[model samples]
Target: MKILVIEDDRLIGDGIKAGLGKMGFSIDWFTDGKTGQAALAAASYDAVILDLSLPAMDGLDILRGWRQQGHDEPVLILTARDALEQRVTGLQQGADDYLCKPFALSEVAARLQALIRRRHGQLQPTLSHGAVTLDPGSHTATLNGEPLALKSRELALLQLFLLNAGRVLTRAQLEEKLYSWDHDVSSNAVEVHIHHLRKKLGSQFIRTVHGVGYTLGDS
Candidate 1:
C-alpha cells in the first residue's frame, strides 16, 4: 500500500517511514502540510498520516480541504497528548484515527493496519488466497505451510495482490502500490516483481488479462 505522511518532526516521520516500509508499505513523506496536500491532490494513496500542527498549513485545514474535495482516504492524525480538543476537532473534520506524541512505532503501525482493515471491512490481519498467505504485521508470506523468502518489492507485490485478490490490477496500479515517490521505477519494475512472485508462489497463482494486467487466482 502507498501512504502519505505529513509530519514536521523528522525523527518521528523517519521512524514511521522506515518501520512501515519494512511491513511492505510504500510511503511518501512531506514535512509541511502545503506540499503534503499538493501531493495528495496530484497522486493517489491508500492512507495518510497527518500531523495537526503544521508550518504552511495546519493539519486540520488540510484534512477539511481533502474532505471537502471528496478525498475520503483514511487519515490518522498526529497530535500532542494535551490537545484533546484539537484531536476531537480533527475527528469531526474527518480524521479516521489519532495518535499522541511519544508513541511507539508498533502502536502507530497497528493503528494504521486497523484503519486499512476497516476500510476493506476485513478484521483479519492475515491475507490468504488458496495456499498462499501474507501477514502484513510480520512481513511474512507462506505457501502451503512453507515459509517463503522474499525481497522487499516482492513482498509488497504479493501483499497487494493478495489484498486485492480476484481483481484485475493494471500495471499502473501495481506500480503505485509497490513503489514510493523517491524510488526510481523502471518501465519493467512491475513485471520484474511479478515475475519474482510467480517463481516463489507458482506461476498459476497470478493470471494475466493480456492487455489488462494481473490477478491472483487459485491454482
Candidate 2:
C-alpha cells in the first residue's frame, strides 16, 4: 500500500520510513506539513502518518485542511504529545488512529495494517485474488498452494494490480505505485515490470486495453 509520512524529526521520520518500507509498503516521507499536504493533494495514498509538531504548518491544520477538502483517506497521528486532550482533539479533527512516541515499530506497523484493512473493509490479514494469495505480513505470494518466487519489485507491482483489480491502470498510475518520486523512471519501466509479471502469472491475468492501459478480470 502507498503511505505518506509527515514528520519533522529526521531520526523519527527515517526510522518510520525504513520500518514501513521493510514491511512492503510504498512510503513517501515529507519533513514538513506543507510539503506533506501538497503531496496529499497531488497523489492518492492508502494512509498518512502525521506528526503534530511540524514546520510551516501544524499537523492539526494539515489534517483539518484535508478533511475540509473531502480527503477521507485514513490518517494515523504520531506525535510526542500524549495528553488525553491532544488525543481527543486529533480524533475530533478526523484522525483514524493515534500513536504516542517512544512506541514499538512493530505496533506502528500493525496499526497501519489495521487502518488500511479497515479502509478496504477487510477484516483479515491476507489479500486474495482468485487462486492467488498475498500475505503482506509474511511477504509471501502463493498460487494454487504453490509458492511463487517473485522479485521484490515484481511483487510490489503485482500487489498494486491485485489490490486494484478490474481497474484500468495507466502506466503513470502503475509507476506511482511501483516506483518512488526519487527514482529515475524510463518510459519502459512499467512495461518491463508488466512483462515480467505476465511471464510469471500468465498473460490472461492482465488484459491490455488497446490504447488505454491494463486491467485484471475477475479471475
Candidate 3:
C-alpha cells in the first residue's frame, strides 16, 4: 500500500520510512504539514500517518480539511501528545486511529494495516484467494500451504490484487499504488512485476482484459 507520512522530527520520519518500506508499503514522507497535505492532494494513498505537531499547518487542521473536502482515505494520528483530550480531538477531527510517540514500528504497521482493511471493508486479517494466503502482520505468504518466497514489491502487488479482487486495475493505477513520488519507475515496471507474479503464481492467477487492464483470476 502507499502511505503519506507527515512528520517534523527527522529521526522519527526516517525510522518510519525505512521500517514501513521493509513491510511492503510505499512511503512518501514530508516534514512540513503544507507539503504533506499537498502530496495527499496530488496522489492516492491507502492511508496517512500524521503528526499533530507540524510546521506551517497543524495536523488537526490538515485532517479537518481533508474530511471537509471529502478525502476519505484513512488517517492515523501519531504524535507525542498523550492527553485524553488530545486523543479525542484528533479522532473527532477524523483520524481513524491514534498512536502516542515512543511507539513501536510494529504497532504502527499493525494499526495502519487495520485502517486499510477497514477502509476496504475487510474483516479478516489474512488475505486469501484460493490456496494463496497472506499475513500482513507477519509479512509472510503461503501457496498451497507451502511457504512462498516473494520480494517486497511482488508481495505488495499481490496484496493489492487481493484487496481489489473483482476490479480491473489499469497500469497507471497499479503504478500509483506501488510506487512513491521519489521512485523513477520505468515504463514497463508494472508489466515486469506482473510477469514475475504470473511466473510464480501461475498465469491464470491474474487475467488480462484485452484493451483494458488486469484483474485477479480464479485461483
Residue 109: error of model 1 in Å? 1.4
Give the candidate order by descending lDDT.
3, 1, 2
Query: Candidate 3's residue-wise lDDT over 27-53, tens digit each?
Result: 999999999989888999999999999
The prediction achieving the highest TM-score against the true structure is 3
Off by over 4 Å in 1: none
Collision count for each candidate, in order: 0, 0, 0
**What TM-score, computed on C-alpha atoms, does each candidate reach?**
0.93, 0.92, 0.97
Instruction: Please give, for residues 100-132, the per-residue lDDT of candidate 1 as tens digits.
Output: 887888888778877877787678998888888
- TM-score-better candidate, 1 vs 2: 1
- Per-residue lDDT of 4-64 in model 2, one digit per residue for the tens? 8999999998998888777777789999888999998888888899999999999999999
- Which one wins on lDDT? 3
lDDT minimum window of 10 residues, candidate 1: 78-87
As for model 2, its CA RMSD to the true structure in angstroms is: 1.7
Q: What number of backbone clashes does candidate 3 have, counting pairs of residues 3 or more apart or in separate chains?
A: 0
Clashing pairs in 3: none
Better of 1 and 2 by lDDT: 1
Candidate 3, 86: how far from true, in Å?
0.3
